[model samples]
Target chain A: MAEHTILVVEDDSTVRELLKYRLGKHYEVYTATNGKEALDQIEETIPDLIISDIMMPKMDGFALQSALQADKNTRVIPFIFLTARADEEARQQGERKGVDDYITKPFDMETLLSRVERLLERIDMFQNQLDAEIGRDFSNRLLPDHTPDIDGYELDFHSESRQQGGGDLFDWTETEKGTYFLTIGDVMGKGLRAKFYAFSFLSYVRGTLHTLLEESTSPAALMGELNDMLLNDDVLEDTFATFLLFHWDPHAHTVTYANAGHCRPVLMTPDGATVHEHSDLILGLEEDITFSEVSLDLDPGTALLSYTDGLTEQHTQEGGMLGEDGVRDLAVDAYDDASSIQALLDGVLSQSASDSFEDDLLVVWLKRLAE
Target chain B: MSFDAETASSETVIIHVGEALDFRNADDFKATFQEHVDEGVRQFILNFSDTEVLDSTGLGSIFSLYRAISPDDGKVAFADVSEPVQVVVQLTRTYKVFRQFPSVEAAREAFAE
Candidate 1:
């Protein structure tokens, strides 16, 4: 156990000496004459907690707390305000500024010490929980490199997680000659469990693709097999995922796709943009589910975009959804401008009402080349 | 996390879920539902018209409630499931486990039947 460090800010020398003497027995105490001095002390060495008198000269305690709250580096340090005036307004102001604790003047030394101990314990517990979450999230996060080079086709993919670990996963792999497999999916929840499920699903798909490509490359067959495999995993009973799988053949100039309750993929042609809607339920729901396949001829300069529900379900400023139609419109505009897939996806995100996303976002776009 | 439970009939209790049922409020949701079950309320009508979102944990909590009442032959149905909540329920196949109705009145009538 490390000796906790505490900074005591007080203008009166007598009170400062008393605090230092009492707190020093349990913690390493640092002294500051006023708020200004305390700021300088914090810059030098950030203490575990700060104890300051409210009515000090050369920058009052409120100003000091406000400044500390404004600073990202020192904002999270546990703060305790010592106030001579025990008025409701002062307490309310302290509460509004997010002070950790408050001690009225003429208070017992024992009371102050116990409060400090309790606050430090709470801070330690919170820090442990946060560190564990970050560790789990970091360990589970997966970011694949750029798509592999394929002849006569341009592919672009983008994905963002709302948290440290998100539920969205997308991958593109060339299975054989002129044939590629692309998939995008979203697990039911967020955080560590979602990430684990996503990684497991991705690996299962990849493994199955390798084995099944030798037998059959039919999208419908692949989806059906994958559904059976997922249904066998009883641990995933409470969770589910929406997935879109595409099989592209550059030599044949066609793309066969299967949907599993994911958002409809948008097809952008010279004429306009159209959504490829299918009547498929989400994956992992049942063992005997069947997924139908749809094949489309890849015309020169045609773009197909697949994404998770996070994109269409984005909220607008007025609380309305961007919806599938909005995404289609964006795709149509992007196709008209002939923008890069990355630029088009960026445009879609920029139109989001809030800067913070509530769910993971994934977008994959592929355009056939004119030969 | 607010739960409003109303005695719809002699054996049915309609629990109106408040906004946002997710990981943060899952425990409270389960606890509130369990409290009603403990008081001999067998039939449950979960009204989700006010619920804006429900994640996997929220679904897990509902499943837990279902499991708790299953052995006793207690009934659990959903009413007025919002779009967001319906998406989770449908995707997880939870809708198959619990019957769904358009309104609380409909759910209560199902319990009566």
Candidate 2:
């Protein structure tokens, strides 16, 4: 039925044929005489499950697994090892290598079949839960969480995920000194694997940035320090993000901010829409990259919308993306929509074709409402 | 989302990117370029004639290659950048670091070795 794909890699033709004969009924079966052959077969069809024999002619199952793990594309294919000698040491070696499951030489067909089915179910279930998790993270991280309840200011944020977890992250922290800091970042990547990378990056930011934020309120200076931290860190060596950090000074009615290669924010005033065009390089690029901390004093009846590219990159009915100018205009138009930023976001997002956005739409709207 | 590289010389390489360069293929893009870097190609010229989408992640990948080739005074340039890719380059101001040319032939001429 081609419902699923199963790859069987065994040096012995008899075992390979038996697996193909049985698993072929429920799945599209592919057989390889050895681990090297399995890899060659994998280039054509990526199977949902792989059953590999540890002992092979050219390459062993362990070596094949290490090869698969080396590649980002084939890293997560559910792998099982089959061996004749099922000793404790062998099991430990497989465990250390991240083998999903193992079957001994004298294994039951029903046991192997059930294990295969259950593992596939778990994989699918995890995929489904990822959607729900992203939704929860969107709600949990995006607004009203660490946001300060400052006087004379209205702040709101929201995210519409494409359900792909495109790594749009937002966080805010009010320090012990009452210095309010807000940050919006987008980790550069797409899809599930990137989601994990994004999650780690975001968590590290949430965990580590607060202490760093306490050391300096100058957004640009703090950004340089963050750059150094990222450059020196091992886990985030390959990761990159476009981050905008904002410091809202309620007493001065001003917002001081620094941009690390993020999209320009659209500002709405009585005159017209003004775009913040200045920005430094994105994070994790180079050492000693400096960002400028620019301060803007707010006026009554003013609104500023800072967002990731998702807002502007939405496709229109004409198959064109809404560019920077389009976003500025729409944001200005949305500013007059209603009293609520959520309504404004609803209005802005309604511009997309069929109300379906292709990426994660994230925005942090700051409004100085009219007196 | 995909890349093809042409060898102009042992020191220079021209990279052709198509349609999209976003988070989906940023790592692949970097890895692809790194292979050329390993092969002693220090100069890179990106041909983005067919590029329509260039996101922050894609820029980061380009930056990665830039960081790799920069220590030895290596260079990266853009030729025939599409409008969308132009938007990203302008916004990030990466053009300040990486130079641009009108065409791949021009880039090759600039790096003729």
Each candidate's DockQ? 0.24, 0.58
lDDT of 2 by residue, A1-371 (tens): 12788899998988888888989888888889888898999999998999999988899889999999899888999999999979999889988988899899978999999999999999888977976676556435443454556677778877767655567777887766666778788877665444555667666766766777667778888788777777778877767778888887767778899998889988888678989887888777777777898988789978888888887877777778887888877777678666545665566557768576677878888888777
True contacts kept of 1: 0.08
lDDT of each: 0.80, 0.80
| Per-residue lDDT of model 1, residues A1-371, tens digit only | 45799999999899999999999999999999999999999999999999999999989999999999999999999999998989998999999999999889998999999999999999889876885576456434444677867777788777767553357888777876768888877766656667777777787788888899899888888889888877676665545677788998887889998887777899888888899876376676545767899998889988898877677668867676677888898888777454555566666667777775656777788888666
Candidate 2, pairs of clashing residues: B1-B20
Residue A8, candidate 2: C-alpha displacement in angstroms? 3.6
User: TM-score of predicted model 1?
Assistant: 0.65
Off by over 4 Å in 1: A1-141, A234-237, A337-339, A356-358, B5-13, B30-44, B54-78, B81-100
Q: What's the residue-level lDDT of A42 in candidate 1?
A: 96
> For chain B alone, what TM-score does every candidate structure achieve against the true structure?
0.92, 0.94
